[model samples]
Target: MSKFKKKAEVKQEIPTSSMPDVVFMLLFFFMVTTEMRKSSIEVKQQIPKAAQLRKLERKTLVANLYIGQPTEAKFGTEEKIQANDAFISTEDIIRWVNEEKSKLAEAEREQLTIAIKGDKDAKRGIIADVETELRKGNARKVLYTAADNSNARKN
Candidate 1:
């Protein structure tokens, strides 16, 4: 009975040294696979619905420009242009485009496209102004984003 008790006292414990390694692997996997939002949108933009819409193949090559009314009442109900997280004037569009263009490589400059997400009720003149600024900055590639209206009848 003493010998049996001694054998029982000598117990083998499962090693947990690799537990941290396993946890770290899972953390790394999620970090690599997750798509983080690059910028926070401050404006409220209800993009127009469209029957046909195509997704951008490369997210890195796209810069988002949001146009809509301010989400907060203090900012007024008038429509505005938002670049990154702040409201930008039409005159500032040129500067914003240049800044974004500078971030890209020379070869990639031509490939970079500005994705304009304007509200359905926003003024068309503002859209045209944004386009003109884009051209002035030598960033001519522009993409207008619209919500997919999959239920719409095809002609």
Candidate 2:
């Protein structure tokens, strides 16, 4: 009777093999749905033609500079930085550039770059002013992006 009772007992617990599959599925779902960072402002500028531009493998950091019509001042002017008492200045551009440069590794410092976004209607003087400020802030490697053209075959 004891031997028969022992044979009838059943062991019950969660299996281990399926746990890894569940974890992997969760990770894959998040990866596929992750959102990419985008510029808060848009530009309508014509990107200068470059014959020797090489594709970058990755972007470590980015500082956005919006060049367009001067911003309107409001009643809460004291709380914010204003430009020329009528427009918002490009003062923060340098600071942001420096912040991005600081994130580079010792060996990758030379590879740091800053992308400039300028509106089509924006004056060349504004762009030049922004460029001068960037140069003063030690950002020499600048790349200007253009609208995407999609008429090529996919490899």
Q: Provide the overall lDDT of each model, using Cα atoms, as 2-decimal numbers.
A: 0.86, 0.58
Best by TM-score: 1
- Could you give candidate 1's per-residue lDDT for residues 31-148 as a string of tens digits? 9999786677778878898877788888888888999888889999888899887889988988888788789888887788899999888889888988887888878988899888
Per-residue C-alpha lDDT of model 2 across residues 14-81, encoded as one tens digit per residue: 79899999999999999899866443332233444434445555756444455554333433322222
Instruction: Judge candidate 1 at residue 130 and give its lDDT.
Output: 85
Which is the leading candidate under lDDT? 1
RMSD of each: 6.4, 10.5
Look at candidate 2 and tell me the lDDT of residue 101.
70
Considering summed lDDT, which 10 consecutive residues are worst modelled in model 2?
77-86
Pairs with backbone N, CA or C atoms under 3 Å apart (clashes), candidate 1: none
